[model samples]
Target: MSWEKSVRRVTPYVPGEQPKDKNIIKLNTNECPYPPAPKVRELISGLRYEDMRLYPDPEASSLIKALSGYYNVPEDQIFVGVGSDDVLSMAYLTFFNSDNPILFPDITYSFYDVWAELYKVPYKKIPLRDDFTIDFTEYYGDKQPNGGIIIANPNAPVGIYEPVSKIEDVVAHNPDSVCIIDEAYIDFGGESALPLIKKYDNVLIVQTFSKSRAMAGMRIGYAFGSKKLIKYMQDAKFSFNSYTMNRPSLELGIAAIEDDVYFKETCNKIIATRERVKKELSALGFTFPDSKANFIFAKHDKLTGEELFLALKNAGIYVRHWNADRIYDYLRITIGTDEEMDKLISFLQKYL
Candidate 1:
């Protein structure tokens, strides 16, 4: 209460719980269940401790070059940040300056509203359809001015992936406003809108190494856009903090990108496991959306989400549950390894 009135006094976003015990099977955060590519470990262990004395690359040149080559985008079009959260926050601060409200789905990433409030940006939530799918047309028609648009493809909590064609429709209609696709979970199953960057100058695609690359602990995230948009976000970033990247992250991130075979194999494994678990949970009388991401959002026929969430927590199996309206009965479960999932399923068998 003693802080300045203008200081950030808004309610903050609460991330999934991180328990102290290592015995817990954490299925709440939607992080990659497997380890990062072996090269990451090899590279990090060999990295000289003496290099920490010097500041890391301000522009994150090596990693950007690797990403540019992998995604076939130009190096100049890439923007690297602490995490996708940082990149999105910078994007919100930089691109959404108009007095008009930004647009996002009502039940998408919980952090969207927190960032909007922290930056004092105006934003409006468009309702998801009855099945929790995005209606691409809801963003069109010019009835109201939108400052910008952002959506999580394979949206968080719901785990429903919108097709690329639908994404194109939204970006095409908002030619003047920045349209950002938060593709944090795209690597699992959804088609990427990265190709649209070549055609639409106003589009931005943000992704993370935290999910697919299993580097959540490393905190690396990046974005790609037209040269103009990238340049503006870069300017905003440098102004905020020039050396946002550190020595270990800049080096290890490049290692993660170089191991393409391992990356795809890990994603494929998670996808396979997700499909199998979906069938098992369904057999247990749970109903969920058709998930294309590395997680499933489900509600049991006889159990409230809160009840099941507590039951799993006591059993040392963690998954996410929200108290928010429309989703209070749902639990968002991250797809972990086969063994971990077996444990989860066995624990849930008692509910039947």
Candidate 2:
């Protein structure tokens, strides 16, 4: 403990409990219940043993090209990393160098503040409204004083989405500050702010394959922004780690993006199941904000979030719960497959 006083001491962010038992129904993490695209498996199965000897593409060129083709953004404007966590962490280091406090929702991805603290960057968490909706006025670039901004479109845990026009307002007006729109769950039911990049050089739209692409284990995430912004991030990434994406991940990420039909199909399936579950939860006296992401933020009339979370855990069904203020009563349930959801609903019927 006394190794070095100079070593930075900081409390790290805790992730969702990943139970070891494979038999348990895990909806705690918002991972895609479906398997990765068939092409991903096919590509992995065909991976060459000789490929691992050398390092992956330092810049993730081929994967970036694949993303450019799929998202229709230029390659130079794209940047890929191990995951959105890595991308966001690098972004915080690269862009949020100013001494002023960075702004984000009080109840957000949690990692936002972790990265901010890890890098010793100043940050402020603006509280969401009573209904769990963000006040765009609080983050207005022109009206507010800020060093940087990051908003999760179709925000996590809460699962609510902000309109693209509202998001564009923040970007367009914040012409000087760096504005990042984290779109990890945009594939579920929200409109992406990706197109805004063309109009605003200060904006960066980050997306992850973990949710919709069913490649959480593969760990692929990317960002789209102006070439100038990407260039700065790219330089920061190389300075940190040249080869972030492994060869297998790069290949599989490309495969996942290529199967656009399968991608849409999987996302639609989750969305359909989410809508159906909403009705059933409502019948059980639960109320929640309309979710556009892959999860639902629900609170029951009688059942406390802690009670339900523990009860479900005892029953071997897992859902996410937070102990934070304003949302302590809510449970964040990931939309699993139809059968898994049916099981969850059936199990809850006894309590109803």
Q: What is the lDDT of residue 214 in candidate 1?
A: 97
Put down candidate 2 lDDT per residue, 1-352, tens digits, no spaces.
5778789767898888899999899999999999999988888879998979998889888999999898898999999999998888889989999877889999889889888888999889989998889998999766677889999989877899999999998887777789999999999998899888888889999999999999999888899999999999999999999999999999889888889899999999999999999999998888999999999999987878999999999999999998888888899999999999999999899866
- Which regions in candidate 2 have their CA more than 4 angstroms from the true location? 1-4
Tell how far residue 232 is off in model 2, in angstroms: 0.1
lDDT of 2 at 150: 95
TM-score of each: 0.98, 0.98
CA displacement after TM-score superposition, residue 345 of candidate 2 (Å) = 0.8
Q: Candidate 1, residues 38-57: lDDT per residue as tens digits?
A: 99989988999998899998
Off by over 4 Å in 1: 1-3
